[model samples]
Target: MKSEYKANSITLAGAIAMGTGVMIGAGIFALTGQIAQLAGPLFPLSFIAGALVTAFSAYTYVKMSNAYPSAGGIAMILQKAYGPTTIAAAAALLMALSMVINESLVARTFATYLLEGMGLKRTGWAVPALGVGLIVFSYFINAAGNRSVGLFSIVMAILKVGGIALFGAAALWAGGVSFEAATDGQSTQIGGFVASVALSILAFKGFTTITNSGAEVTDPNRNVGRAIIASIGICVIVYLLVAFAVGSSLTLEEIIAAKDYALAEAAGPTLGRTGFYLTVLLAIVATSSGLIASIFAVSRMLAMLTDMKLIPHSHFGMKGAIRDHTLIYTVVIAGFLTVFFDLSRIASLGAFFYLVMDIIIHWGVFRHLRHEIGAAGAVLVTAITLDIVVLSAFAVLKWQSDPLIVVISLVLMAAVFAFERFYLRHLRDGDAHHDSHAKT
Candidate 1:
């Protein structure tokens, strides 16, 4: 019914811009140093490796969207694969929460760079305050409507990419640093490299945001897949270049030391105060736009879930528009996360949840929905295998370094499933009565 209700308003370029905006947000600017610390001189390679894994992960989305295009998107796919049962509800919520986690991650990144550029201290409440303020601002923008979000995404995407390109080029030009410095003279650990690849996978995870916009994109069938492929391709090139520039400019130790503000720091050597200000300006724009786009997608996702009767709804003294309630809920949770966690912890939690959710998606497609979607069994199997391998490696690494985050991720996942089961049980008789009335 939602597919029939709303007209296609997003152009192909708009869709691609939305995806790129989300991917390029906090990822390269924040995670480059983190990845560098883990992968050492091979940090750039981790992004390329992540892109390869993303290609496999994306195959499931392309096949499903081509077969069944809807704004419901992944939620619809999950229902088709596992029925409108607990698995569908829980897995969909996992994705929604993962996006929420990313919002807080981007917000914190915005605050960190903003403070650093101003030559201010990053300690105490400064970071969280700015982060929460941005979340509130994005909520208001999302409440304005889709057209505003789309236009802003397009503008911000262009500006952010150009700014990043300039930073990379100018830094490389000014420093004249060699590739050997960035890619050599370090002890490389296989496990750490694999784990870092998992983090790099998070950097490009924004491509899936396009699938969530299927019902809104013009020519959903063709454009959804096209936008996704184009987004990933463009991001791969951009991420590789930025990683090289950062690595070339700063040693691994320097990068890790200023991991939270690496991009702005990278500017100090090349363009001095002016470039730092410019890079900071772009980061703020990118993170703000990323928050707006993510809020738009996740709010729509939860609304779709409610429409399908997969989740409960609450008017909460507001109008009956599900998007309104979901929008409020998204900002509140993201603000809470931004207040409590640092960037690395938030990212690790998000990556853990997302990889697990992605594994479920691949499993659903491979084991049950592959034939219906006309997907190759081999490709589906390969996708699932890769996700599992990466997820396991990342989990081991997290367990060693930050076992608390791993525990939090597991407990949160369990809570989602448990809550869904209880809610479904509570509504079983009512659902049966509604079903009987409809049939009659």
Candidate 2:
């Protein structure tokens, strides 16, 4: 039973690989055009803004992990702050679900880019079918355990990061560093720009992948924090390079028009067919590795939640470990999203869920755990303030642009809390009934 919960120790490099694997997968490959749509000509700058905000948000997780690292990264933080209650459970569930959403987002991006190579676009049932296939492939790779995931992540991270940076440099050189997006006269409002930050934050949120696997890292206390900072720093550099590459290679309209496969589009005109195909290959590696790392971390988080009794769990009559069952659950739900929602809707839902959970985390630490964790109140408060602002902007934009998703997000979140509250109360009543009978 204990062996089922056991995780192989990951070195600092492996941890960083895992973090960047998840970050780069969805961030750069699929999100560049989407960011451009909202941020307009200065879309490259949005990654920087997102990184700055993410740095503040990372402070809370770093402090918490340094003080008390555990397997259930975000879950531990929520429970420590709020106790065994509905708020903690519901918030933890939100984080877990958001990670699952990300898996689908990147998987769909994989499908989108792959279709580009085939001279096909993401307009039909084939997109989600391919996305679901990738998710299944990742599940097998992960079933081999942490060593497989870590080594695969390190190798894939090296390939994609180096490949992406190379593409960026080459595009800048060939395109003569044009700033066409700005001069083209297309612009965005402040709200639009702010809303784009939400997507950008999603790009960098892979750092939580590190915090979630703290128990698996060697030197969990120090290396966990180090990996988080290093991963973020590395992503900021890579994301900026790619953003500028895309901006220089294409106009704002060109970017948003090809939003689903912008990197491939940019590569084709600037780098020629070979470079274009190479970029497609890199997208495959990035999104697939990202999906692998994401599924690995998210399943672990769900298993942790079940162990803590924060969420209900049943083996459903087939499982080697709690994690084994959770892994299936993670992929099934992710595959469903891939099948139903398009990339844009998937990204939007993930952003909303993540920002809401992030606020809950910051607030929990500020109200209760700061003193025990030795975190600065100002930093925690800043994270909360920033999240609120971004989430508000995103909500308004979604309400205006795609109101259906906004309503769906609100309903889902409310329903999760309601479910959690009822489950906890039922457990209490069951225990009380047992107690009275025993006394009688």
Model 1 residue runs over 4 Å out of place are 1-5, 180-184, 433-440
Candidates' RMSD to native: 2.0, 1.6
lDDT by residue for model 1 (1-440), tens:
35433648888998888888889989988898888887887688999999999999999999898778777878988888889789888999999899999999999999998898888999889999999999999999988877788778889899887788778888888877675435556777888888898889999999888888787788998889999999999899888878877877777778888898888887787778898898898888888888888888888888888888888888879874777898899899999999999998998989988888898888998889888878999888888888888888889988999999999999999999999998888789788999999999
* Candidate 2 runs further than 4 Å off: 1-8, 437-440
Instruction: Please give the clash total of every predicted structure, in order.
Output: 0, 0
Work out the TM-score per prediction.
0.95, 0.96
Among these predictions, the greatest TM-score belongs to: 2
By summed lDDT, the worst window of 10 consecutive residues in model 2 runs over 1-10
Please write out the lDDT profile of model 2 over residues 1-440, one tens digit for every residue.
Answer: 23444454778988888787778777788899999999889998889989989999999999999888877789999999999999999999999999999999998999999999889755778899999999999999888887798677789888877888898888888887876777788766789899999999999998998898788788888999999999999989989888888888888999989998899999987899998999898898888888888898888888889988899988889848888999999999999999999889999999999999999999999999899989999999999999999999999999999999999999999999999999999888998999999999
